[model samples]
Target: MYDPKIFKTYDIRGIYPDQLDEDVAYKVGRAVVEFLKADTLILGRDMRLSGEKLSGALAQGIVDGGADVIDIGMVSTPLVYFAIADYGHEGGIMVSASHNPPKYNGFKICRERAIPISGETGLLEIKHLVEKGKFEKKPSGQLIRTDVLDDYVNKILSLIDKKRWKDAKRLKIVADFGNGMGAKTLSNIFNTLGVKMLAIYSEPDGSFPNHEPNPLKEENLKTLKKLVLKEKADFGVALDGDADRVGFVDEKGETVTGDIITALLSKEILKDNPGAKIIYDLRSSWATAEEIQKAGGIPIEYKVGHALIKEKMRKEGAVFAGELSMHFYFRDFYGVENSDLAILKIAELVLAEKKPLSELGRPIKRYFHAEEINFEIEDKEGKIKEIEEKYGALQNAKVSHLDGLKVEFSDWWFSLRASNTEPLLRLTLEAKTKELMEEKKKEMISLIQG
Candidate 1:
């Protein structure tokens, strides 16, 4: 039987060979082509050892389904998206598990113009087709090998202000690639922009020789923080395995949350395009929305997930959108997350301001946020309902059921959402004061745990 769990909300991912292997990968490829009714398909993979085999199997299935394939080997997730949109291909596939461990790999499929095919989109259709296991064999389609690295770089550079970058004071920056795909793309971007870069673990090692590529966890950022401090760099940035999202460290080596990055970038983007709508996920700190409005940009809140955010950006004609998970989306990027742009924008912000990142970020750092806490529970949905019911009774409390149960009071707010994949409930609480944040966190955790 096909492993249903591998078909997640965002992509198809699981342990290699056991839950996901060559056979499944091939079927997914065929199913994607069949579902999209496409003639040409683009494909790429990360540096994982299994990527090559899985991508090859996928290509075989695509060819068997009589679809021409443009195979760009060993690329980041964003690059795959770039290729599809750049070449005007009908669809594309990226074999990557993103920040997941090396043993896990998956496929991120996109439709025409590089639009994401999530569970709510066309992912379920592909899953059903693959499970049926009946594919007509047509004459095999030809495979073409091409590289879009130069094109991708040129496109991004065109969006940046070369004169401003050249005129700004040279700043030293540190980056930890986590031995993922960032080393390949970020190095080239930085080198072209002529920034002093002290790179760590920049090599593309699927083994994740240093730490896991996920910078959301504070522990994963320890080494980057140390390097930034020891080197006394202007600031630092870290990218996940596939380089679609990024994390930041200030000059003082303090990890900057994604919401702060969102606020900062929103201010920058709005300076150029005032009144443009800026989208942030619901879980983001209130400061994100406040800062966006302060910058004269319309702040719009949406549910989390790249697919959802991208759709919202397109629908709202948003200038930029950010997720708490470090994914930053741009309208210029065909409504997809591109951390490369995010890194450049941050560098420009620091260089132009002539202040440390922490100092620049201080104005928007106006809240106390209890970082996301996850609890494994059997009755995840019931627990969320219970938390909502408990908190919903509070006077002047507002509850929003967008992606989860978010109860907002005058001074504090908390959100409880059931995990889409795991049997877990996640909580995020924020307040006007640290004491209040702690008090609300404790009060909510008790309800969730019980």
Candidate 2:
């Protein structure tokens, strides 16, 4: 039941039943409560079919460990974060694989204020406890079922200034929930904001009868792109399995990269809080930083991953932060991911500018971005070192080892790093010209993949 490999950098995840099962989940729940030394723990699960058994087992373990369980059944990943923070629970567990295939299931554990439990933080201790397979015998606690969706929606609205989006009703958009837990809150948020939403596959389905919930895959986004153009809507938004990540399609049926959204949101945020600091992942396009600076905001580049981003945002006092993976974090959201809040801000922009989504996204897209590419390699660290040494030797090259290897030349830049959740090396290259971007991409891929 305790698979050591299932313990990941940010969370615990693996294939269902085989790598992770009810027994493992039950042990994890007990371990988490004991690790946090808490009396109550908030729990939520995504739309995965195994979520029922896993959540039930987890809640029983928590209760057996003398920790009451506040089970907010069947919701998106974000709501668990909201519940932990809003209700002042000591810790929370979200039973989700977060964009993984249906065969996969995992847990995203968080502590007070919804702070993530990364490996460096306290995950190892929990793993140690789980492997021990022992819990102190105590009086069993109660299982409490409640819904925090209403409060979660209210919190999302409080973060957005409704006065600025008075014309949201005029905006028409398509949202592909991909049959995940996204509809749990996103559809409601859109409706409450008076946006004309054509939501497809909004029903929560673990089987994902349509396309998989992962919007990062271009193939999965085909339906969304076609719908946006067919309906002639302002834009389209696609949410991942758990709605913690989101992707956008312009009205012209063009896919909008997450870094571009980061750039746009940075500018929008700076309008209200000039000279404030903004955080962006190092893999983002240079346009993100330039736009932040142009809008009178200080741009700070941080390491990738949701856990690292939240820590950096709080440390830097950043008003907003976004990743190339479409995960946007906000100070208003208490340093947590809120796909609904990001959409709300985007809606405000569309309503206020009255411009096509493509036009609105055009300015910050000054540089050509090679969408992140992955390579299956055995010696991920060794490859990164070899590439780093070669690039770091270049004259006038600005290199950073912040997350992995990032070397910036005058016209082009590239980043290479191992994925935290997968055993693969990820590369992101950008340049001033399309040809240059392609050229650099080829040059970098050889060293990393070869």
lDDT of each: 0.89, 0.90
TM-score, predicted candidate 2 vs. hidden true structure:
0.98
lDDT (Cα, 0-100) at 265 in candidate 1:
95
Using alpha carbons, what is the TM-score of model 1?
Answer: 0.98
Q: What's the lDDT for candidate 2?
A: 0.90
Candidate 1 lDDT (Cα, whole model)?
0.89
Which regions of candidate 2 fall more than 4 Å away from where they truly are? none
Q: Highest lDDT, which number? A: 2
lDDT of 2 by residue, 1-450 (tens): 556999999999998888889999989989998999989999999989999999999999999999999999999888999999988989899999988878999999999999999999999999999899988897999999999999999999888887887888788989999998887687788778788899999998888899888878899999889999999999999999999999999999889999999988888888889999999999888988988998999999999999999999888889999999999998888889889888888878887777887998898888899988999999999998898889889899998889888999999988888999889999989999999998888888777667
Ten-residue region with minimum lDDT total, candidate 2: 441-450
